[model samples]
Target: MKDLKGKVALITGGTKGIGYGVAEALLRQGLKVVITSRDENAANEAADSLASKTNSKGAVIGVQADVRRLDSQKEAVNQALSTFGQLDIVIANAGLGHFGSIEELTVEQWNDVIDTNLSGVFNSIKASVDALKESKGYYITISSLAGTNFFAGGSAYNASKFGVTGFTQAVMLDLRQYGVKVSTIMPGSVSTHFNGNEPSDKGAWKIQIEDMGELVVDLLKMNPRTLPSKIEIRPTTPPSK
Candidate 1:
C-alpha cells in the first residue's frame, strides 16, 4: 500500500468539487495538504472545514492563487513549502468549461478555457517539479471524458480537455525517469460545480463528489511500481432516458 502518512500534497482549485474532495481524503490519511483557490475567503473556509473534520489544522493550509497565472502558482508553491517544508503530491484539478458551436465560440472564450485548463497545468507542474523530484512524488490531473468524446456544442471544452490529456501524458513520460509518477483521471458526467453548473442544482444526476474523493484515496494506496496512468471513472448507473 502507498504510505501517505507524513506526505505533503498540493491541490489546485481545492475550494470545491473534486479538488476539495481530494484534499479532504489526503488530510484524512495524515498527509499535509495545501489547497489553493482563487478566492482567499473560499480557500480559508475549505481548509478549515477539512482540518476540523480531520482534526489536523496544522496539516492543512489554504492559499489563494489563480490557476491561470504563473505568479499565483508560485505563491501557492511557496506557501506550501513554507508551511509543510516539502511536497509529495500534486492534483491539477483547476479548469474551466465553455460550450458552444465551434463557429459561435469566440476566440476570447477559447483562450480562456485553454489558458486555465491546459496552460495552468503547465505552470503548476513547473512550480512543483523540484519538490516532486525531491520526494519521488505523484502527480494527478483531473481530466475529463470530454477529452475523448466530442459533442456538437462542446468545441471549446473538448479542445481544452484534449490538450489536458495529451499534456499530462507527455509530462508523465518526461518525469518518469526522475522517479515521479504522473496520472490523469477522467470522469464521466460527475455532479459537481464544473463549468457553470452548481453541484447542488436540481439537474444534478451523475456521480457524487465524494465518490471521486474515494477514488483518489484508493489511487494513493496503489503500489509504486504500478502507475495507473489513465483512469476513467463513470457512474455505475446512468439516469433513465
Candidate 2:
C-alpha cells in the first residue's frame, strides 16, 4: 500500500453517507481530512464524530460550503490548504438525485440535480485543480450507474450522472499531463440515506458505504504509473425485484 501518512484530503458532501465513510477510510491511512457540508453544524458534528471513531484527533476538520457555488468550493479548498498545509486529494462526492418523468420533474428539481451532480463537480475541480496540480494529487468523483443505464423516471438524474461520467473522463485526459490523476467511481444502488430514503435491512443486498470507502483507499494505493480512469462497482448479489 502507498504510504499516505501526512497526506491531506478534502471531501465535499462529507457529513454523512459515502462521504463520511471515505473520510474514515482515509483517516485510517493517516491522511488528514477536511469534510464539507452545506450545514455548518452537521459538518462540524460529523468531523468530530469521525475523529473520535478513527482515533485520529486533530486529523479531521469540517467546512461548511455548498458545491453549487464556485466560491463555496474555493473556500473549502482554501480551508484544507490552510489547515493541513497541503492538499493531496480531492473527492468530489457531493451529489443529489431527483427521479421523475420529464414532464413530471419540476424545473427546480432538474436544476437541483444538474447543479449538484454536474455543475457542482465542475466547480469543485476548478477550485481545487491548482492545489492538486501543485501536489500532483488525485481527483475522484462519485458518479452513479444511472450514468450508463437510463431507467424510467430517471430523466434528470440520468442526465446529470451521465454528464458527471463524461466530464470526469475528459478531465482525466486534461490533467494527466500535469501528473494529477483523475477518476470516477460509478456505483449501483448504494445503501445510503440518499434521495430521502433511509437505508434499512431490506437494502442490505446493495453496496454498502464502507465498500466505497475501501475502493477509494485502494485507488489511492494503486501504482502511480497505472491509473484506473473509470471504475464501475455493483453489489455481488443484488436482490431481484
Candidate 3:
C-alpha cells in the first residue's frame, strides 16, 4: 500500500480485455506484471506488447495458465516470484460466459462458467495467499454487474458472477486482519472483446478497458484503513430503448 513501484502482480486471463488493460496500467505505474493466458503464444505476445507500450523492458512476464486448474494458478504464482522475486498483487481476471436459459444450458457449459468465473478466483487466491500474506498484498477480482442483476439467458453467467461477489466479500473479511486487501470490481457493459464481440468505437458508450484499469490503480492507492469490498460501476448514460 505504501508504494506500487517495483511491486509484482500476477494477473490471470491477462492476455486481453480487462486483464490486459490492468497489466498496462500497472506497468505504467512502474510495477512488474505477470500476465497469464491459456495460449502460450498469446501470453508471450501480451507481455511483449505491454513492455513495449510502457517502454519498460523485462518488467512484464507471461505465464501460460488455465485458471480452472489449481496447479496452473500455482505455477503462475511461482513464475511471478521466480522472475520478479516478490508478489504484491494478484488479479483473478480469468472468466468465461455461457448464456442460455436453464433448460437450454448444458451441464458442461454451466460447469465451465462456474469453474472459470468462480472457482478460478478461489484457486488464484489460494495460490498467492502465502506470498500476499508476507507482502501484505492486494487481491482483486473483475466481476460483473450481472452478478447482482439477473436476466433470462444469463443463468450460468449470473450464478458464477453472483458467487464471485459473495466469495470476494467473505474473503475481504477473512484477509483484512492480515493486512491483505480484497476487492471485487463489477462493471456493466464494457467495450471489450468479451464473448464473441469485437471492440470498436461503435461501442464507445460502454465502459472502456482503460477506465477499468484506472479504477484498479485507484483502489490500490487507497489507505489501508479503508477497503471497498465491492464496487459496481455503470455507464453514466445508456442507449435508449
Which regions of candidate 1 deviate over 4 angstroms?
200-205
C-alpha TM-score for every candidate: 0.95, 0.98, 0.98
Which residue pairs show backbone clashes in model 3? none
**Local accuracy of candidate 3 as per-residue lDDT tens digits, 1-241:** 7588999999999999999999999999999999999999999999899999999888998889999999989998998999989999999999989997888999999999999999999999999999999999999998899999999999999999999999999999999899999999999999888899999978989998899899999999898889898999999888999
Candidate 3 wrongly placed segments (more than 4 Å): none
Ranked candidates (TM-score, high to low): 3, 2, 1
lDDT of 1: 0.87
After best superposition, candidate 1 residue 170: deviation in angstroms? 1.0
lDDT of each: 0.87, 0.94, 0.93
Off by over 4 Å in 2: none
Better of 1 and 2 by lDDT: 2
What lDDT score goes with residue 196 in model 2?
93
lDDT at 134, model 3: 97
**lDDT by residue for model 2 (147-222), tens:** 9999999999999999999999999999999999999999998999998979899999989888999999999999
